[model samples]
Each structure stands twice: as C-alpha cells, then as structure tokens.
Target: MPNRCQRLLAAILLFAAPVHAETLLCHVTYGGETQDLEARPVSSPYTVPVQPIGSYFLFRIVFQKEPADLAAIKLYVFADRDSGPLPIQQATHPYPPLAGKGAGFGFTGLNQVYEPIRDGELQYWCEWSPSSGPAR
Candidate 1:
C-alpha cells in the first residue's frame, strides 16, 4: 500500500510541475501566465533608487535563485486621470528564467520616454496586474 502511494505521489509531482522555459529573463514565474507585467512594488518585488531628472520610471524586478535572472521590463507611466478602463504601459521583454532552488530574479531602471496624456493624474498599468493575485 505504501509503495503504491509513493509511486502515485511521484507521478503527480512530475506531471504537475510547470514546464519552465529555456531562456532566463526572470528567475521565476511572473504571476503565472499573461507573459507581461506592470512595474509595481508588489508584482516587481524588487526596486532601485531613482535619480529624478528626466521623464522616467525607476523600478527593480527580481526573482531570487541560484543565478540572478535579469532583463528589461517595459513600463508606461501615465497621467493618473487618463481613463479608458485603466492607465497603460507597454512591455517588451524576453521571458526570464525560472527560479532554481531559492527565489527568482529580474532588473530595474528608469524607463526613459514620454508617452504622454494631456491632463490627468499619474497612474500606470502593465499586462501582469498583480492586483488580481492574492496579497503577499
């Protein structure tokens, strides 16, 4: 009986594990699916200090693991009041590596560019909206 249960458990563990990608953009999964993600404190987990000069957004994206996986995550800072469901940011990046044995990994910097709205408060959005996820 115990042997049967062990075999079942091993099968479940092997089949259930997600198929991690080959390339290492981030050392862990960002959310789960939806490939893209917003540059927020929660979703991003890591962050960097801002110099505060040109129009830019500074954020650090990290996944703790054996090796630090890093890449450029796209971000768009918008006028908060700018409406149409939600404020938006376009992300263009290669998918990161999966977390090895420890945590995940990623990168951070001020996205320098002004994709502006005329008049509104400052708000932002990316594909990976962690808001929908359970709080950590």
Candidate 2:
C-alpha cells in the first residue's frame, strides 16, 4: 500500500537525520544572587565566552559533540582579578551523560568555588538536556 511505503520512508528519514546536540544549563550563585548560563555544542572550544559573576568571579562552559568518541562538556570557574581572570576550578563530563534526568550530571551538588585572594565564594550546579527543543 502507498500509505505503508510513505510511512517507512518517513521513519528512515528520521533515523538518518543528524543527532541534535545536547544543551547544558548551569546555575551560578554569588553575592546572594543566581544566574543561569546555557551552553550548546561548539565546533571550537576556544570560542566559548567567559561570563562575569557579581564582582569577584568569572565562569565559562564548553560543550563539544564532534569526533563522536571524544565528545565532552567542561565547566570553568575563575577568580576575577585586577590583572585578569585566573582559573580556579575545572570540571569535565563525557558526552551522552549516563546520569539521567533530575539527578543531572557534572557538578551536581552545591559546588563551591573559592577565590583565594579575596576569600569570595561561587556556587554552581549543572544539568543536561537531550535537546534544545520543547519536550515531545
């Protein structure tokens, strides 16, 4: 039947389409305020931008999905200094994170990053979503 043939074709097309990159959502807290940062996969890790948090911290997230086998997600925390941003902490998680919904992946708990010089604290946690689109 033509209807059956059309359905088969549609299924094939769906499976053949490229996989959508996952989205990373990070909640960063500082100075009694919280900010949400969202990161999508990038071809080049160097292109990721640093986000300033309050007056003493900077944050960055890098998501990579290429080379399939080497895909990963990374989080960076920095101390905002007069000279420049200095790296304080780095966290990495493999692609297609095993930990499912709710539990989340990378830096799951209340992770506290400290700035040694000023004794400032930055708290953060991250979660991963299968896709950027709305739930089906």
Task: Output the number of the lDDT-best candidate.
Answer: 2
Candidate 2: residue pairs that collide: none
lDDT of 2: 0.80
RMSD of candidate 2 to the truth, in angstroms, is 6.0
TM-score of structure candidate 2: 0.74
For candidate 1, give the lDDT of residue 31. 21
lDDT of 1 by residue, 1-136 (tens): 5698899999999999865322222211212222233233223434432211123222223322223354434332322332322334444443332222222223222233342543222222222222333121
Write down the lDDT that model 1 would get: 0.32
Task: Tell me the lDDT of model 1 at 62.
Answer: 31
Provide the lowest-lDDT 10-residue window in model 1: 22-31
